[model samples]
Target: MICFMKNNLIVSIQLPLLILFFCSCSLLNADEGKEFISIFDGKTLKGWRKAPKTSYEPWSVNDGVIRGEGKENRLVYLVYSEDENLKNFELKFRYKMVTKGNTGVEVRTRIDKTGKRPFEGYHADLGHVGIGPGVLGAWDFHFGSGTRKEFPCQRGTRLVIDSEGNGKHSPIKDAINITEIKKRDWNDCCIVAKGNFFQLWINDKLSSEFTDHISEGRLESGFIGLQLHDKGMVVKFKDLFLKKL
Candidate 1:
């Protein structure tokens, strides 16, 4: 009887130890991923500029949030820039909608003082609904303005850039799949842009995968912006951290 009790204790202890070892290994494997950078400092818009606005209201960084209040069907943008060049880096941020509307992170797009509608650019094309058709994962030739009648060109399609970072868009990346994260709740988004390929991870789950080739523009590196749709739209972002992998 004594020997049997001792054997049972050994088995219990060994099982717990084995469980712990496997858990540690899982965490280590997760850490071994590509590099990334966090554009938001959660303090101020240090690397951003309040670009030309189409409305009187503007985008601002306050207490670590990049926020916008939409107006006139034009939610302007606050853009970012860096003196150094960047390539093949992932960016992560948390976005929460104060109220449901349209918004998305803008990448590889540019604007001038005239607020000339994302001059020569691409927008992520995000709304409350997720459809695998647009610049990021879906397509609708949605020009700068909204329209009931569709254009001759397709909308909701992703863009393509060359090695020099200049290119036009095509349907090479077929469709984008997004994780249906909860609205008004803090959800993490990861964007990986490498040459003509980009991938998106939502809430730590692989969502959209994009690979395209275009020759209209180059995307070696460019400003990042957060946009809100028309007026009364508000979204909050926080705890944005990135490590270049």
Candidate 2:
């Protein structure tokens, strides 16, 4: 009986330790298996190009950052065409608004050759407060008919759109506080797109959540771009990373 009790105690201890060891290894493997790829070279615009209709001439790279000085008469875009047709992926980058009017990151976008707007897609909106209502920390939708829907998913809101283009939203209590966004400092932005679900995080806080069931209006694959909204807006982007999910 004494020998059996000793063996039982040993087994109990060993079992817990073994389980812990396997869990640690599993976490390590999951972290190591992430396949994030840096999209920007930080030295030159090797894999990106300016849109054909971009009248602005101030898009440049300096000090390992992509800078856009919006001095154009209209909106312009710097497109990422190296892998234009990305279906579902995760994108992360850091941005700083030097002198903000309005700026945004475009995903699943296509250039409209004969349209007034430069591209058609979903925009992750960012701008200084008082620029406009939908210009800051929201999701804007642009369609081919020049239909722009601003603030479909606002900051601190969770939204769901039905197949017929109907939407419903509610406030998320734990979402990012827009006041925490720095005016003249760098901010982190992360976008995750999987199937019909999309999430946007700013400064590591959930800013917006969206699920699109609208098959007709949804885009499955398209290019990415950085927007220069009108004139007198200055923005910089760095550390652009993408992971195919």
Candidate 3:
């Protein structure tokens, strides 16, 4: 009888400890993602600027959103001019391809104060998937001398850029779900960068992944920019948030 009572007591004690252990694990998992801070005020372009030597006519803020238009049929950039030069971070924003041509987010980018192109760095490419190919859901590389390497990792693909700046790519099935994205409507976009690894998510689905080992061209830290590419493109962005990883 005494042994039975002791066994019951032990079971009761062990049960609570197990429950506590599980609860702690749950809390840790919940906190795994880093915290983000608002980078856009939604009312004004307070912390952003047009790339130097570029026209500001393409960008505006209205109704708590940033809008860009490719009225001139030329490349332009609205760059994040704040002090933070991010090396490893996650950027979250909502984008709407209003009258789509080509639009994208630029990260780890160096702004050209007086060059022909707006910046040099990696591009998280986006556009109306209806536009197709190079313009739609891809990763792009830019150089300072008005050169572009388009679609290193197109939608539903993975890419690796070797030390010699050569890219090897492979398709990733279901990485981008076209049916899940709303056309002519707002969509959630996320770009995560850690070391040389990068990921692009559209509507919460992984769209592309890239690993950069291009010692000659890869950038470790730089500004962020929103791109307005080619003619007749209209894009809107809001809820710009950044989480340093």
Residues 1-245, model 3: lDDT tens digits: 01235578787776765344223212212335666678898889998988644544888999888988876767788888874488887777889988857889889888654485666778898888586645566787776663434435777889987776678988877676777777999887778788898888877577888888866556788989899887778899987877777
User: Which runs of model 2 end up more than 4 angstroms from their true locations?
Assistant: 1-34, 113-116, 129-133, 146-151
Judged by lDDT against the true structure, how good is candidate 1?
Answer: 0.51
Q: Compute the lDDT of residue 42 as modeled in candidate 3.
A: 81
Residue 181 lDDT in candidate 2 = 80
TM-score attained by model 2: 0.81
Arrange candidates, best lDDT first. 3, 2, 1
Backbone clash numbers for all candidates listed: 39, 0, 0
Which model is ahead, 1 or 3, in terms of lDDT? Answer: 3
Query: Per-residue CA lDDT of candidate 2, range 1-245, in tens?
Result: 01235578787776764344223212212334467778998889999988755544768999889998877767777888789998777777878889857888888887655485767778788877556535666777777763434336777788888766678898877787768788878887777777887777777677787888878657777888888886888899987887776
What's the CA RMSD for each of the models?
A: 10.8, 11.8, 12.0
lDDT, residue 150, model 1: 24
Segments in model 1 whose C-alpha atoms lie over 4 Å from true places: 1-38, 54-57, 61-63, 83-86, 112-116, 129-179, 216-218, 242-245
lDDT (CA) per prediction: 0.51, 0.74, 0.75
